[model samples]
Target: MLKNKFFLIVAILLVFFVVYYTFFGGNTASVDGLEATINPATYGRQVVEKRTEKDQFLRTNAESPILDKASFRGLSYFAPDVSYRVVARLEPFADKTQKLVVSMSDGSEEVYEKFAHAVFSLHGEACRLLVVKLENTYSILFRDSTSGKETYGGGRYIELDPKQLTDNHAIIDFNTAYNPYCAYNPRYACPLPPTENKLPVAIKSGEKYIAHE
Candidate 1:
């Protein structure tokens, strides 16, 4: 009788595991791979706070990219939308030693390694972007359909925190995208987005272009 009860308990546990995996594990693409829980409200609030701090820095900091501090108006931006935050599957390049030469706005060129490809979906469209190792973190230099019309003409950049990335996935938050320093001052040599990194969709989130005085 005891042996039969043990087998019955094991079968019940197996059924529970299957049901849980079917409902929850299938959603791995939506949540941060390292973090199981995602709070949209809190994430939106953090994005706002960071943007506010950036505006303050641009307005007052001595090393700010804005050349005319006195007449400098705050930077423009799209409203924070949590939907722009996406979880991307990171696929490392087969040839890790490959180098990508990118042109700069100042006529110079910068070299970057072809680190990985970040694949994700946004606005019901499949997207893939080239990732590169920039200093200690990873960065994506990209131009979207909004370029030259709604955002900066040259391009915009998004830097991923190395700590936030897992082996196979990372968070690609378009809400944190920003124009390069060259957009504000031509004195700075900023790297332009490569042809492969140009996205076909209109990314309506992140910073917008404001005519500087």
Candidate 2:
């Protein structure tokens, strides 16, 4: 009888421990846990981290000739700013066949459909950008007043997730803006931003121009 009682006590204690751990163990995880991970700082860090990884990848890639032979420490970027992150209204261009001829550095033109426009504000100044569909994701290539002086002369690019657009509103984070490959190598023919995508305000965020050595 004592042996049976001891076995029952052990089984009861084991079940209670399992239940408590199953319900409470996940709380001990990092602050960036499974559900509460979305935040502005997290996004900013992710952008910088992704860019750093990309630069390293480009520097070592055999096919990426831009950084393979060029001696450079790393790509330049403005400090991540949450102010550059804005929620915009995604307005569709009425004309279904509206196409834009984006000039390439190689003196070539790439035809892109202007599917939509993202209208947002920066430092209280109104800004807009043309959106183009690239395969499965939407993208924007734009230039601001800071283009020549701070960012890449050819401007910067940002990709948007179509699935994230809710009720015609999308979050456009300019802090994640990046320069074109042509900025690093002339052999790369990158598409230039069209006239409509130019902003009057200086966007002091994103990748800067790196002169080729």
Candidate 3:
């Protein structure tokens, strides 16, 4: 009977820990668990932590996109700014079965399901972007005025966690946008951003690239 009670107590503690972390974890990326009172300093630190982890992975991971790992000096990124983190209202597509075919870097095409339209305002300008289900998670493929100047001309992607969606709203943080693998290696066949995803504004956040030949 003592053993049975101990097992029951352990199970209860495990459940409590799971519930507590799900609601109070300091996961900056997860809008669902992110604290509402997070300040810029804390958010910036969390973003830095994520970037550091990515750098470590790219430097040591065998599957890294960098061909010459010896010369990789880590990726460049704009300063973390909370201003770029905006809450967007997701509008579901009327035709849920809609599929979008996008051109690939290697002269091919890939099909993705139209997820929703993320409507938000950035820098006092109202903007809307098409979100698509690219494999497992929803992603936004976009090209801004910074393309070809400060960022990759082929565009960048911002992946959205399905768990981050709360009441048809999601936090879209441009600071986390990243270049496609093709930016590092031409051998990669990355999907290009559709024309509709192009933005007139210059997004100064996210990753930057300079071709090294």
Reference-based lDDT, each prediction: 0.86, 0.76, 0.85
Residue-pair clashes per candidate: 0, 0, 0
Candidate 3, run of 10 with poorest lDDT? 28-37
lDDT of 1: 0.86
RMSD of each: 6.4, 7.9, 8.5
Residue-wise C-alpha lDDT for candidate 1, range 1-213, written one tens digit per residue: 999999999999999999876665544544444553356666678889999899889999988989888987688999988888888899998887988898998899999888899999988999999999856768999999999999998999999977669778988889999999888887899999988888879999999998674
Q: What are the runs in model 3 whose C-alpha is more than 4 Å off?
A: 1-37
- Per-residue alpha-carbon lDDT of candidate 3 for residues 166-209, written as tens digits (9 for 90 to 100): 64777788989999999988878999999999987899998987
The best-first sequence of candidates by lDDT reads 1, 3, 2
Candidates ranked, most accurate by TM-score first? 1, 3, 2
TM-score of each: 0.82, 0.75, 0.81
CA displacement after TM-score superposition, residue 107 of candidate 1 (Å): 0.9
Model 3: pairs clashing at backbone N, Cα or C within 3 Å? none
